[model samples]
Target: METMRAQELHSFYGKSPVIQGVSFDLEPGEFLALLGRNGVGKTTLLKSLMGLTDGCTGGLVFGESNLLSLSTSQRAKLGIAYIPQGREIIPGFTVRENILMGTFARVDGRREIPEYLFEMFPILREFIGRKGGDLSGGQQQQLAIARALAMDPKILILDEPTEGIQPNIVKQIEEAIIRLNRERGLGIILVEQNVPFARRACDRFMVLDKGRVVVSGHSKDLTDSVVEKHLTF
Candidate 1:
C-alpha cells in the first residue's frame, strides 16, 4: 500500500495557470471522488498528479519521495499509473500488446500481465488478439484500465473513467472501479460527473471549481443541495 499527498500545488499549461492552490491526500486503499462542473480544472489536476502538465509547483509526495521533482516515467516506475480520459489505447496494437505496454513501468522488469486483470474484464482475454481500435468505447475503457493494471501500480489516477460510455457499460465500469478499490485495495482518485454514482461508490468527495477545491467532505456530506450548487450546469 502507498499513499499520495499533494500540498499547495499549482500547474500550468504554457503561460496559463490551470490548477491553483490544489491540495489532497489518498491514503492506501482509500477512494476519493474529484468532482466539479465542466471547464473546471479537474482534468488538469489529474494530469498534474501524473506529471503530465507543462509544469507544476508545490509538493506532491508519495511515501518519502517528491513526485513533482520526478519525470513522468520516473513517477510511473514508482507505481503510479494514469488512466487518462480518452482511454488512449494504441489503435493498431493488439489487446495483448496494449496491455503489455504498461509493464515497461515495472522496475523489476517483469513482463507478465496479471491474471486478475483478465478476471476483472474477461473480454480482454477473449479479445487478446484483437486490435485495440476495434473494441467499443466501453471495451476500450476496460482495456485502458487493464493496460494500467499490468504495471502493478500502487495508486490509480483515473480521469473521467465513465465519460462517453454507454449506460449499461457505465454501470459495469463503475462496479469494476469500486471493486478495484474495495476488494483489490488499490487507492483510487476518480474524476466523475455522475453524482449519484460518485456518492454511492466513493468514500470521500471533493468539489473543484476554478482550479481550487471549494467544497469537500465525506461522501455522506455530498448531499443533493451541494450537487445542485456546485455540480449542476
Candidate 2:
C-alpha cells in the first residue's frame, strides 16, 4: 500500500505499555479519524508510526518500508508529515520562516513559499510578514497545517486540530481536510476528541479504549451509543 498501515503495533513509556496490539490501515485518499480519550495511546501511536518512539515493537509499515528502523527525519523524507497537538509553530520566526522549515527534507533548499501553496491556503499570503507568535490561535493552527502541507506529504497526521480553535475556524480546517483527501488524493489520519467533527471529516474511524481498538468500521456505521460508550468518560 502507498499509505500507512500498522500491524499489532505496541509501544510503552517505561514498563507500562501504551499501544497494545493496535492495528489499522489507511488507504490512499482516505480520511481516518482516530478517536480516544486522554492518554489512550493516540499520540503515542502517531509517534511510533513516525519513528519518534525509542522502543517500538511490531510492524509499522509505510509504503512497503518498516518504520521501526528509520529515524524521524527519514520517516518525514518518506512523506509522513505530522502536525502535533498544540500547533507547534515556532514562536520567534515569521510565518514564512515557520513554513519554510518544512523544506528541510527537500534536496533543493528554497526559502520561498511556492506559489502553489497559496492555492491551498490563500490566507498564508497575507501573513507572510507576520511573526508566528502574533497570529491568532486559529491562524496559528492554520499555519501549522500549512507548514506540514509545505512538505508535500503523501500522508498528513493531524492531532486535535480543533481542540482549542474557534468553531468557524474549525469549519474551515475541516473543509481543507476534505479538499486534501478528495481533490489532492492525500491520506489523512486525524486524532480528535470531537465526535461530530470526526464523523463529518472521516470516512472511516477507529475508537481506542485504553490503548485497544474497541470499535472500528466505516464512519457511516457509527451510532450515538457507540460514541458515548467508547469516547466518553
- CA displacement after TM-score superposition, residue 37 of candidate 1 (Å): 0.5
Residue clash pairs of candidate 1: none
Q: Write the per-residue lDDT of candidate 2 for residues 1-233, one digit (tens) a residue.
A: 38678888888777778889998989888899998889888998888788776577888888888888789998888888999988889989998999999887654555556676677667778888889999888889989988888777889999888788888788888888889888888999999887887888799999887888999999887789988788778
Query: What is the per-residue lDDT of model 1 for residues 1-233, given as tens digits with 9 covering 90 to 100?
Result: 56799999999999899999998889998899999998899999989988888999998999888998898999999988899989999989999999999999998899999998998899999999999999999999999999999998888889998889888888888999999989988889999998899999898999999999999999999999999899988
The C-alpha stretches of model 2 lying farther than 4 A from their native spots are 107-111
Give the range of the ten consecutive residues with the poorest summed lDDT in model 2: 105-114
State each candidate's clash count.
0, 0
Worst 10 residues of 1 by lDDT: 1-10
Q: Which stretches of candidate 1 lie over 4 Å from their true place?
A: none
- The root-mean-square deviation over C-alpha atoms between each candidate and the true structure, in angstroms, is 1.0, 1.6
Q: Best candidate per lDDT, number? A: 1
Candidate 2: which pairs clash?
A: none
